[model samples]
Target: MNRYERTRVLVGGDPGVAQAIAAEIEEICEVEVLDAPREELVMVKVRESARNSLFYLGEALMCSCRVRIADAMGFGYVLGSKRNAAYNLALIDAAFSSGEEFERMPKWEERIEKEAKRQRDKRAKNRALIERTRVDFSTMDGDA
Candidate 1:
């Protein structure tokens, strides 16, 4: 993934990642908040598989914030209720948007990939456990 992709995943996925990035940026440049963080119910969209028509899936809880540094405006929208983490994500976005160099992402790439694998493994394990409990009700009495 490129810088923006890496930033998106790191910021959106883990609050710790955002905080880590923010701390690194804070050491060098001043981060200014343009808009305070707030939580709201945001509409999520889904598409029809056949016709590709879009519709609202439902409202998802979101925390978002906007920040600025120099002349660049940065925005962060993340799932869940971590208001502070959202602000940190926005701050990291602002730092990158302002054309500052950050060297943390290389380290983050490894960490993020590891975390992703770990999550995938955990999910697969859970799925297998759930699958083992599955039984076909129609076949329980040998009814075809």
Candidate 2:
């Protein structure tokens, strides 16, 4: 993925990963918050598996904020009611989008990739655990 994509993935990813990025960036760069974190309701949509149709799952509460670093503007939107986390995301986004050179940024890319992998692994493990306990009753129809 490109730099901006990577940055977004890191910023929009798991809270721990986002926090790490925000914490590290704060030590090296200056950030100015353009918008305070605020919550809003947004419609959540889903595709019906049985039919090619879309439906609204319901309104999701989301947090959003904007930040500025140098001349670049960055924005962040996330699911749930985390004000501090939303602001952190905005700051991290702005720092990366600033286009200014930072020596530690390359290292950050590696960290982001690692964090993503970790989350994927965790999710896979959880899925496997859930599937294992899901009994397939159809397989026992003949016995009954």
Candidate 3:
């Protein structure tokens, strides 16, 4: 059985509308709701078992307004078969959930840049050492 699980609910409207639907779902299952006003959509995620219920709730939300269920990918290895699904969901979630003033973590970016620089430096050093050790066979005498 797959360990990791996720359920996505897509609703249409503003934050207030999304929050209401999310609150209702939260009463029955653990969920995180993200509102994207620019896209006119709200995303909700829950556990695998709660997917059906979330879908039903999504339908109800749609009836009240215009909304579309973007996508749904159930339980599986998050990094394997479901990588793309997981990634897309995360991107949407992050974009919507992050506050208006939210900024990317500069420290994390700096760390990655530093690591890449170190790797490049190590590779250059290795290449230099190999070149320095390369022997010119023509310059050596057959016998001492």
Give lDDT tens digits, candidate 1, residues 7-79: 5567546557668767776786777887799998999999989998999998999888998878878787778
Error of 1 at 130 (Å): 11
Estimate, for each residue in 1-144, the C-alpha lDDT of model 3 and write its tens digit.
Answer: 011111112211122322333333234333332322222223344445854443322311111111122332121112223233333343333333333222333332343345446556887999999999999999999999
> Candidate 2's residue-wise lDDT over 16-116, tens digit each?
77787788888877778788899999999999999989999999999999988889887878788988788877876787788887888787778778877
Error of 2 at 14 (Å): 4.9
lDDT of 2: 0.80
How do all the candidates rank in terms of lDDT, highest first? 2, 1, 3
Better of 1 and 3 by TM-score: 1
Best candidate according to TM-score: 2
Global lDDT of each candidate = 0.74, 0.80, 0.34
With a 3 Å backbone cut-off (N, CA, C), the pairs that clash in candidate 1 are none
Which ranges of candidate 1 are over 4 A from the true structure?
1-4, 11-14, 102-144
Supply the TM-score for candidate 3.
0.28
